[model samples]
Target: MTTMNLPIISSCSVDGCSYNHDHDCHAGAITVTDAAGAACGTYVDASDKGGVDASGRVGACHRSDCTHNDHLECTASGVEVGAGADRADCLTFAPA
Candidate 1:
């Protein structure tokens, strides 16, 4: 079986979301887009945020048909970010 490693959140995309620190994603849950570059409307937060060694990682690609959805984790190689209603960002994006 192909064992793929999950992506880690390095920063947040939402501006002033009370989870971003210098472009670093610190939110417990983050919003991401679909394979068609559309917003998935899924916000995932980390259980442990702003704490001692808090590993803030968001995984919301639960769709089985989704290419990025790898065992409930986003395996998409690269992701884009923007400041609009259609904007989307992946917290678990990694290069194939």
Candidate 2:
């Protein structure tokens, strides 16, 4: 299979998320969109104590309304994670 260069998660501040380890996202990739006011869309509740070994990349962006969204994938080189109504959010989202 052809390997795609996944987008790098520049930073994450969601301490309570399941994919967060040492303030970094461990998901294979992340999705961004408008939900609960600027949400990460990838945040998952952690039922365990530790995180996975994988680092998160920007996979699909549901915000077809965002300028950075191309074919549902994020075109941004990097994305910043921060606080939102749901705790984690993709800060790079911008309305198109």
Candidate 3:
């Protein structure tokens, strides 16, 4: 099967998130948007850490209004995650 080249998470500023490490994300893949308005659904604010030792990528995006969204996937080269109105949000999101 062909592998999908998902969008990379260039950076993340949500220090409270369990998956955030040194301003970077470590989840294998992250999901953004839905009812949360480009929010990072993968964000978790627990005292304990989670995820692996690799950079995160965008596995799926539910913001159909976002310019980079295509078929529920993110088409951007990369995305930045940070704290916004929500705990975590996609900084690269742009209205379509």
Query: Which candidate has the top score in TM-score?
Result: 3
Q: Which residue pairs show collisions in model 3?
A: none
Q: 1 or 3, which is superior by TM-score? A: 3
Q: List the candidates ranked by TM-score, beginning with the highest.
A: 3, 2, 1
Q: How accurate locally, in lDDT, is each candidate? A: 0.45, 0.75, 0.85
lDDT (10s digit) by residue, model 2, range 1-96: 111465678889877788888878888777776585557877887766454576678877787887877887777777878886667888777778
- lDDT score, candidate 2, position 19: 83
> What is the overall TM-score of model 2 with all chains considered together?
0.80
TM-score per model over all chains = 0.46, 0.80, 0.90
Query: Candidate 1 on 2-25: residue-level lDDT in tens?
Result: 222435565446554345455455
Q: Candidate 3's residue-wise lDDT over 1-96, tens digit each? A: 112488889999998888888888989899886756588988888878888887889988899999898888888999999867687899899988
Steric collisions counted per model? 9, 0, 0
Off by over 4 Å in 3: 1-4
Residue 29 in candidate 1, Cα distance off native in Å: 5.0
* Candidate with best lDDT: 3
